[model samples]
Target: MKLSGIFSDGMVLQRNAQVILRGQCSVGGQTVQVVFREVITCTDADPSGNWEVQLEELAPGGPDELVITAGEEKLVLRDVLVGDVWVLAGQSNMELPVRRTLDRLAEEVRGLDLPMIRQFVVPQSYDFHGPRENLDSGAWVPATPEGLLGFSAAGFFFAKKIYERYGVPIGLIQTAVGGTPIEAWISEPTLRRIGGYEATLEQCKDDAYVQSTKQRDEDRNGQWYARLNEADTGLREGWHQAEGEAAGWSEFEVPGSWAGSELESLRGAVWFRKEIDVPVKMTVGEVQLALGTIVDADDTYVNGVLVGNTGYMYPPRRYTVPQGVLKPGKNTLAVRVITTHNTGSFVRDMPYKLKAGGQELDLRGPWKYRVGAVTEALEPQTFFHYMPAGNFNGMIAPLRRFPIAGVLWYQGESNTGQPAGYADRFQAMIQDWRETWGIGEFPVIAVQLANFGPEGEQYTDWAELREEQRKGLAVPRSALATAIDLGEYNDLHPQDKKTLGERLALSARRLAYGETELVASGPMFARMERQGDALRLHFTEVGGGLTTRDGNALQGFSVYGPDGTFVPAQAFIDGDTVVVRQEQLNPPVHVRYAWSNNPAKANLYNREGLAALPFTTEA
Candidate 1:
């Protein structure tokens, strides 16, 4: 007999709730018994060799053992605890680990030990067949200085904060996948009821179609990279070596894109070299190289020795320089960047330096660069894992029997382009998840999309999606965490997950823990009234009353008239309302606040220091 993959040593069962123990016997018609805390439950294995024993409700706190017996076989699980288990779900933002946040929270996280905080990371898997009965692999790991690096940043902080306030052990089930959309996490039945995804799901369900698409993508990309490598002059000439340095390399500014530059249109390999002067004291201890973020892929080398390589873009380029890699004097830093697309550039507004102990060496400014090879832009590949019901089948479905306190959702960037139906779809998915677990109206703490993109861009898709997320609050026992002011304009994966997690914890306090008096949400738009050419907007949840974040004049407000053209409007606080006026917009019909992709000027906040949610009066 063998227990489910989720049941093992160091596992944490839900506290103050009836826990279901499930396993598969070696043969059918066998008696399976589960003994936990001296409470015995027995059941017979069905024809499929599957058996389940539902245990009575358990209280918090444990270092207990769970014993399961099937016929003559016996299994013992050690170091099990009864705690509050929360499912962390969504896309890359939720999947991003604590190690990525160390660049900003290193001092706070270093040497920290919290054994009560544990996590079972669900392996990245997808299946179009049906819901899985068991996870292929998973294990519970407690928070330690070493183990904490792999824990989800948002989930960890949320757990830490919740534990601090409630004094309950926290167990996190990480089921998030990077770059996946909400549709991927919804069940097949849910997707069918939601409709419009039939064609996509049908194509994905076919084994032949899936295999053919994978083969085609592999062939196309394999040939392109192979050809580019063969033609790369840098590799042929050994440009990574100090002795192989060649002349005629053009000078370019660091921390900037290649657009409008000498290598603007190049769509292949490019070699960049920079020389840095290092001190003996700085090279003595641990040394780290921070290249911020790079476009596409990159293989970085220091002193002719490869330090690190990232396959794709989006991840910050942080590499550890070996003790002997940096010398007392001049050291060579070389990077071979591979751009599948023509847009090869170093991202701006990120760290670009090398650090040793407390000393530093700035690797920014000018760098010598040369084109290695040129090729056509690689075609975009399809991700079968993002199809509807795949992740639900492989990642989420197996955990239905496992009880959870609630869910922490931090997605929606992938579906921003089609924001119109997001509200209905999000609500439907929430209901589906609750029904799947047989948990009635469990609290769901959903994060609104953070502010993003260039300031000059006029895209309102993100804003519209935020409104859709707000609409999701119509569901019972749900809360929305606003992240409008927490994002960087240049980076999609923001590093400040601590604040966002704190916001999620606040939501959990009110929605899940029954903290009725707590102000957990930001100011929400309630109603609007038009007075001639100006509009007065009222808001709810104005904890300690509404105010500006920066103590300056209220901004990010706009007015629109019959022409449907929004113009910048002057706004100021009047009692509990915000009055917006645009002289040119006569008989204004609508008003909006923080309606752009990156509404940098949006500073409205409350006394509790939470930014107001983005909204449009037209809704």
Candidate 2:
């Protein structure tokens, strides 16, 4: 009988835990025997030929062999190691590759080669039903340059750190899909147990849901492709030729967005033409054009020759124009930008210039433009329907027989708006995973949401969501890495995944590796005390003493009075406690730290350089 995709010879199982051995056998096979070590256990195969046997917990050290005997066939599984395993799940940032961050991909992989680190990427799939029994396709691959490029950047970095410290094989099971909500990755049963998910599930069940939703998306994609063909056809047929005298076009910045300018809420293809007068003394060999980032996609041409192009947004603008593309006199630089959703400007604060030889050419000016075509508004479509059990069935279910150490997660961005119920949902998901694995309180470390967007005086959902993540530490054997200081205001997907990964490893070292002396987390709010005309906030995990991350004064602390109005409070570090005082309120009723969307000066930290976890004292 053929074995499942997860069942392989050189596999690692969770050490010193209830190991479950499961597989499919031929129909009508009465009995199946599973042998590990010197002990053999026999169990009857089910009617459909499915069989499962739970092996008693064994010691950690292993080079064990598992033999399965069914009917006349004998299958041998060898070279299995016993160590820790973890699951890394999240959205695009967690799914981002190291290759995209640092340009030196080959160098990064060469330094990251570790045989003990193995990763399995769960094939992307979605279903409304509960977890599935098996995934479509996936296998365990060692951490090599070629293999690491496709693995989750955060997960790979975290696993590498842990493997180096613990000297154990690390199995990383990646079950993440980009642009998916938390509800889609969780089980259906788990979602129903939590509120609000029922409404989302109902929306998924609508009869006309798929058709109505995908209509605008289809139109936008179709229009862009059609416009590209039309442009190509025009170029070939001399349609752009002027009858007598062609009016000169002005020059504009090549790579910036056109939304706030002449274009108003327009998406689709737009053509921008710029004329640059080449200096007579300039001996241009190679030219570099920095177009910043186009909203969706862009194809650039210089002197009627194709120079460079980008297929999507998010990539930084740095396209090189080969040495021979420039001319001596007048040069025409044209760009075709295709946008599906949002505005049509190249993102701001990015490089947008051209360089020839050692001389720099500033391309940040006005440019003449014309509309290629007006396409339909691009509507959001749920191409990958997120459903409970869908990910489990396709991504995680097949790995039941394989052993693992624990779980490391860097998610929660998708569920930010529903912060009130995120704690329970996250708890239930963790418990469900633990129950499925039959592992008791396996160490799970998660990265708290980093500070993002503009800082504001008013409360934000992202803050509340981060507080919920902090609340999750109340669950047994769980730790969170605070990344409040590591986020970028403009970029949601920050490029500094290395720090996030290392911080997670720090938690694992303390929790799983028995590093008792190591401080794994920042100071967490423990209890609050009311003093005369002031509120004193205490903290747990006050390693050594409390300190500020920067030399400046502490920020992000807010005090609320009886009326629930929060005002900026004067805060000072008093030993391990934070002293909060507001002249408006004689006695503060509530206190909050790192409460805003992006706290510009939230410098609360421990002596260990770890940023303090965000929290509220309302409860």
Q: Write the per-residue lDDT of candidate 2 for residues 485-528, one digit (tens) a residue.
A: 88877667776777788899999888888897888888999999
Compose the digit string of candidate 1's lDDT tens values, residues 84-105.
9999999999999999988888
Error of 2 at 503 (Å): 1.0
Clashes of each: 0, 20
TM-score of each: 0.98, 0.83
lDDT values, one for every candidate: 0.89, 0.74
How displaced is residue 100 in candidate 2, in Å?
Answer: 2.3
Supply the global lDDT for candidate 2. Answer: 0.74
Q: How large is the C-alpha RMSD of every model relative to the true structure?
A: 1.3, 4.8
lDDT of 1 at 185: 91
Residue 322 error for model 1, in Å? 1.6
Q: Which stretches of candidate 1 lie over 4 Å from their true place?
A: none
Identify the leading candidate in terms of TM-score.
Answer: 1
